[model samples]
Target: MTAPRSGSILTTYRRHKELLLLLLPSMVLLVLFNYVPMVGLVLAFKDYMASLGMVRSPWVGLENFQRLFASEDFPRALRNTATISLLRLTFGFVAPIVLALMLNEVRVSWFKRGVQTLTYLPYFLSWVILGGMFLMLLGSEGPVNWLVQAAGHSPVSFLSNGAWFIVTIILTGIWQSAGYGAVIYLAALAGIDPNLYEAAAIDGAGRWKQTRHVTLPCLAPTIVVLLILSLSNILNAGFDQIYNMFNPMVYDVGDIIDTYVLRRMVYQDFGLATAAGLFKSVIGLLLVVSANGAARRLSGGEHGIW
Candidate 1:
């Protein structure tokens, strides 16, 4: 019996050998890039030194975590992260869905394609390039300020001012990511059955009614899944965007956990920075689990990461 079972396992493995071969590189990369680096997370608990190296670094237990929480900047960074993330979750999350729905409703293929192309172009542009463009556009001597001056108004200091800085980050973030986000929703929309729409129409339902009854219900699971995923990254306030676009003036509001960690690293407080990063990761993990659970309960177990 044991020999036959072993033989059956071997046969099954042989049957799917080609499929496993196809996945080998990706599996290797995942292990190398993702899993291997996870070992470095221990740096958070250690007093790291370049001379001593990771192995020789003395473990300080929770002292690094204590210092991280005690730092004045830490609270500010945490607040800013939560604020920016929540704002993005509320506003930025909806833009793509709305755009996707509007695009889905468009009957003109050429026009819809053109609009999609235009929207998607920005997502492909690195924040490094986009930041420079935005800086130029938002500068006092830039076209935007020039227009404001022309209108007999003062030129607003967009990047310098705290309130405006947050607004600018959120808006730019939406612009950069919304199109890419919409692609997922568009795919989901495409997967909806045409028969449902036809049935709704047969029942004398208008476009809005059909959309409300059929489209939205079908989209609910996708929306829930995406929302849960987004919740997991609530601490990540686009490091590339903020690092490139932010100035010292707006650091009070614009500095997120990532930038805070970068700043700590600049000061050579490796353990503190690592602790902050680890804290962020822990929070992210907790948020993911909680959000997944809530989504499952809310969706009657129909939608969740699990």
Candidate 2:
């Protein structure tokens, strides 16, 4: 009995040997790039002078966190980050699903492919280039403002204004990411059985009704998974986009946790900067856990991110 059991185990391991070999590099990279750096989180709670170094430095429990929360700019930055993130969650989350539905309805494969290519191109462009494009279109004398002022109303400042920059960030966030997000729904659409749609149509269901009753219900699980994953990053708030487009005039409405850390890093306050980084990471961890727990409790679905 023991010999047969050992033989079965060896046979199973041999069957998967090739697949395991292929995955070995990625597992190694994950450990080296991701899990290994977690030790540096200690810097968040320590006063690291060059003389004392990381390990030898005296531990200062929560002093950095205390200073961080006490700062006036931190609250304003938190609000700006939250508002932009919520707006992105609303529009950006749904925009791709809508795009996918429209794409799926396209009878012509070529047209669908063309639409996919056009939308996906923007996702690859760097934020620096996108920033330049927005600047040209929304600048003080740019064509968009040019047209606006060409009409009766006075010219509005796009960059320097706080409120408008918030809108600009949200719109740009959608533009850069929506198409890529659509690719997931497109794959989900491909999984759906065409027989379901045919049956609905035979039952006299119209296009909108087919979408509402058939497509949406089939897509509900995918939507739930994506929503749970998105909730994990509710605190991110697109640091690169905001950093490139914003200036001192709009920091109150545009600054986020990442930008705050970057500013302190510039001043060479490594301790405070590390604390802020750790804070962002910890909040991200809590949000994901809470979101995943709620999802599991409500749906009894399996989406353990860990």
Candidate 3:
């Protein structure tokens, strides 16, 4: 029986050999880059010393985590991360859904295509470029301020002010990401059966009613999945964007877990940095599992990433 099962497995693999070959590199890369790095998570539990190496490092248990919690900066960074993430989830998440809906309603092909192109262009550009551009444009003597002065108002300190910096981060995050997110919804929209729309119209449903009833219902699964993914990354809070755009003045509002970990690594506090990273990963995993369970329950097991 065992020999027969092994032979069947070999026959199945031979039948799908081409597809398996194509998947080989991706499997190798995933193991090398993702799984291999997971071994270093043990650094979070050790008093790591360069001379002693990872295996030889002295175990410190939860000392790093205790230090992490005791640090004055950790709480502030946690608060800021949660605040920014919620804001992004609220506004940034909705922006793409709205854009996709609007684009779906557009009659003119060229106009719809043009709008998509313009919106998606920013997503392709790095934060390094966008950050510099924003800094220059929002500077005291910059064009935005020049326009404000022209309107008989003072120049606003967008980057320097904490509240204003949070606003800037949210708005810029929406601008950079909304288009790409819209593309996802657009693909989902494209998969919806046209017959549903036609049936709705036949039943005396207007465009708005059709959208509210048919389109939205069809989109529910996609929305739920994306929401789960977004919630799981609640601690992320756009590290690259904040790191490039932030400064000393806005640290109170803009500093996040990733940035805090980065500073720790920079100062050669490897154990603490690893602990912070491990904490974040653990939280993210928990969130994903919780969100998935909740989604399944809410949707009667019809929706979720399972």
Q: Highest lDDT, which number?
A: 3
Tens digit of lDDT per residue, candidate 3, span 163-232? Answer: 9899999999999999999999999999999999999999999999999999999998889878877898
**Of the candidates shown, which would achieve the greatest TM-score relative to the real structure?**
3
TM match of model 3 to true structure: 0.87
- The Cα local distance difference test for each model comes to 0.92, 0.87, 0.92
Candidate 2 lDDT by residue in tens digits, 177-287: 888989989998999999999999999999999999999998898898778878888889998888889999988788898898899889878788899899889999899
lDDT of 2 at 146: 79
Clashing pairs in 2: none
Which regions of candidate 2 fall more than 4 Å away from where they truly are? Answer: 1-36, 293-306
Tens digits of lDDT, candidate 1, 1-306: 344454576797898899989999999999999987788889999999989998799999999988888888998999999999999999999999999999999999999999999998999899999999999999999999999999999999989999999998999999998989999999999999999999999999999999999999999889988888788888988899999999899989988999999999999988899899989989888988988888888888977878
Candidate 1, residue 7: Cα displacement in angstroms equals 10
**Which ten contiguous residues of candidate 2 have the minimum total lDDT?**
1-10
Q: Rank the candidates by TM-score, best first.
A: 3, 1, 2
Candidate 2 has what TM-score? 0.86
Q: What would the C-alpha RMSD of candidate 1 be, to one decimal place? A: 3.4
Of candidates 3 and 2, the better by TM-score: 3
